[model samples]
Target chain A: MSYSPPRDRLWFLRRRAYLVFVLRELTSLFVAWSAVYLILLLDAFADGALPAFWDWAGTPWVLALNVVALAAVTFHAVTFLNLAPKATVIRLDGWRVPDFMIVGGNFSAWLAVSALILWVLW
Target chain B: MSPLRRRAEPYLWLLFGGGGVVSALTLPALVLILGVLVPAGVLSRPDLTALLSNAVVRLALVGLVMLALFHAAHRIRFTAEELLGVARWDRFIALTCYGLALTGTVVTASILF
Candidate 1:
């Protein structure tokens, strides 16, 4: 098929959608890093070097970065969860899972796991 | 299938597998490890850096980042095309993602080195 002209395709791509898409993508970057950063911290803690860990974690800049990373992580999780059903295929008993169910499941799972971690840590 | 649909199929697969499966399985652990446990002192911190420096840890980090980056890129591109009315800018977004991935790889290599 021949390519449609931009004018003809304008209905498909609105300015607001473009902005949200860009924001979502940008947030995903932070989400990726946040995961890595967390892993690194966990590994550090597991290695049993408290002084060094505190030194790194206690830094003001690092704290700020962590806050930003938290925001990014949340954005990534929320947006990705919202898009999960559209992006994935989940078959249970020969039936496709509803999109709302998938998203709700993900959110519930995330909350449960996060709560578990907090409970254990506390 | 139309050429555009054909081209988009592989990306959809990657998004489903990498962003969906891989992300779901690994991300929660990452959050628990860093967000709650570390902050609460249940897990030691120095060990995390030391672990990161290990070859296995580094490889996993790099792999996850690369996959997630591509997934995000593909999703963003499609969103721009479908919602932003910017189908013409697909190439631009792709190029930017490629650049970001390359830069990320190089930075990761430097950190490892």
Candidate 2:
């Protein structure tokens, strides 16, 4: 019979990477929450959906929830950006591109898109 | 990888990957706008209806929702099973998670169109 190693419930907690992985995984929930907030913002933008809608959204609880979600989103973004190189590959004429360029390109795209959003909104 | 495992995981991973890019870029910006700027009364809500009602914006918004939802589903599904030591109910959990994501996507689409 083959030998089988016993594992505990906290086996994953033994490693630093595992902890980060779990936190990153949990970030997905907040990512979805952020999407939900976006949907609400979109739906609330009716013909007269201005002061009243904005006013309705200015509650303390909503603010707190959003703050928490924002933190989660920020954390998730940082982790995801760092991990992007691992998941993707870039090649030019049968040559593998440098890692920093690939990562920097992602950051540049992120900044450009975010800047566009800011310009559009403001 | 086993064929059965590969079939489900690759597609899920693709969604997860694409979703990761979109979510990483947009979600942070959104949190900044909605959570801090608007809430702090720094940036007021502009003509959001006009902006969102546009065909391109609506399409993009819908796509973002779908991607983000699937990302959450895949992550949450795996995390739950692993953390909870759930082995036998893997398929059921997956279906539930993906099903929820699909339903959310449908609802968002209907509302948009």
Candidate 3:
């Protein structure tokens, strides 16, 4: 029997698949960073510095940037949550948690955390 | 190594590293919920800086940051190598990521210490 590197044997197929995966995941970096930037704004507001924060956040370009960031964050969260099951290992009493359950659990946790944050600020 | 083991090495590293990040982030949150929030009768009264600056907390934070950054960097490098026709430069990319991760860890330690 003979052996060959998988990349050499399935060059184009592997490349296409990996490219798609990478692009999808790379967008997540933008999303995650945007959330961090948003937290900075929130921190400023919490410190009673809303005037400065709003001045920066209210600029037309800044507003547009926030919108894009929010969209990216949402997209990244959705895709990342959806793929969490495959990327993570979860076992309960020798039984594996279903993929749908993992996704649902992540979304539920996110909602709960978001609600808590909103309640705190409100 | 067996063929299957060799094939699985990269993915196993990613999963282990990624899982470490997730756990490091989540454990403190869980502790805050059970140890502080419920005990203090407050929903979100935990002090972020104090908790994050604690020795154990800082260790976990640094671990999560370094591992996640390296994991992301490696994954990105591989993707760039394949998609951007830079396959020959994968080693360079990997070395760059390693350097970044090492620098990050050192800076974080200095700040925390």
* Top-scoring candidate (lDDT): 2
Residues A1-122 of candidate 2 have per-residue lDDT tens digits of 89888767896789999998898889999998887777776666543555765676677788788888889988888888877987678888989887788888888988998898888887
* lDDT at B39, model 3: 33
What is the CAPRI rating of model 2's predicted complex?
medium
> Tens-digit lDDT track for model 3 on B60-111?
7566555545554555556667656777765577678556656655655555
Output DockQ, candidate 1: 0.17
User: Top model by DockQ, which number?
Assistant: 2
**Candidate 1 docking class:** incorrect
Best by TM-score: 2
Considering only N, C-alpha and C atoms within 3 Å, which residue pairs clash in candidate 2? Answer: none
**What proportion of the real contacts between chains A and B does each prediction keep?**
0.10, 0.64, 0.02
User: lDDT, candidate 3, residue A90?
Assistant: 91
lDDT of 3 by residue, A36-74 (tens): 343443355346564565556556676565555445445
Model 3 DockQ (Cα-based): 0.09
| Candidate 1 lDDT, A3-89, residue by residue in tens | 765555454345788666667666655555654564454455555655676567656676567666666666667777787788678
Show what share of the native A-B interface contacts model 1 retains: 0.10
Native interface contact recovery, model 2: 0.64
* Candidates, ranked, TM-score: 2, 1, 3
